[model samples]
Target: MSLLFRRPTLTRLLLLKNIKQNQRSTICSKPPKEKIGPVQSTFALCVFAVTLLAPAGWIMHHIPEYRRQGQNTST
Candidate 1:
């Protein structure tokens, strides 16, 4: 039917207009200008290291199969 065809075109135009408006608002907004202090930066680095390393440490400690597979591959 003509209604079905026109409905999707109308929906598409509305979605496009909404997206353009959002893009314009973001473009007009100013980004924050801030620098991380040394203490905060160090804490962030420690958090990042723990997040990155803790899982690997847990897997190494608990998963003997991974170690066996590595040994097999290396030898």
Candidate 2:
């Protein structure tokens, strides 16, 4: 299609505008305030810990089975 051969000036202009807006925001915007309320903070920490621990727990649970399989394969 002839449309495919068209120059991307409009697309480039929009991309450049977004980049400039981000630059302005980064330079001008204040950082978010830290949340210190105990209940919210505790809940956040618990969620984060569980998210991290789930994978670790999975790995630990699989290790013994994996080792037993390896032992059987060798013997």
Shift of residue 24 alpha carbon in model 2, Å: 2.2
Model 2, residue 38: distance off in Å is 2.4
RMSD of each: 6.9, 6.5
The residue pairs that clash in candidate 2, if any, are: none
lDDT of each: 0.87, 0.91
lDDT of 1 at 20: 95
Clashes of each: 0, 0
lDDT of 1 at 57: 96
Please provide, for model 1 over 1-75, each residue's C-alpha lDDT reduced to its tens digit, 9 standing for 90 to 100. 677565567888999999999988877566668877899989999999999999999987978888788899998
Top candidate (TM-score):
2
Q: Assess every candidate by TM-score.
A: 0.43, 0.47
Worst 10 residues of 2 by lDDT: 27-36
Task: Give the clashing residue pairs of candidate 1, or none.
Answer: none
- Which candidate achieves the best lDDT against the true structure? 2
lDDT of 2 at 42: 92
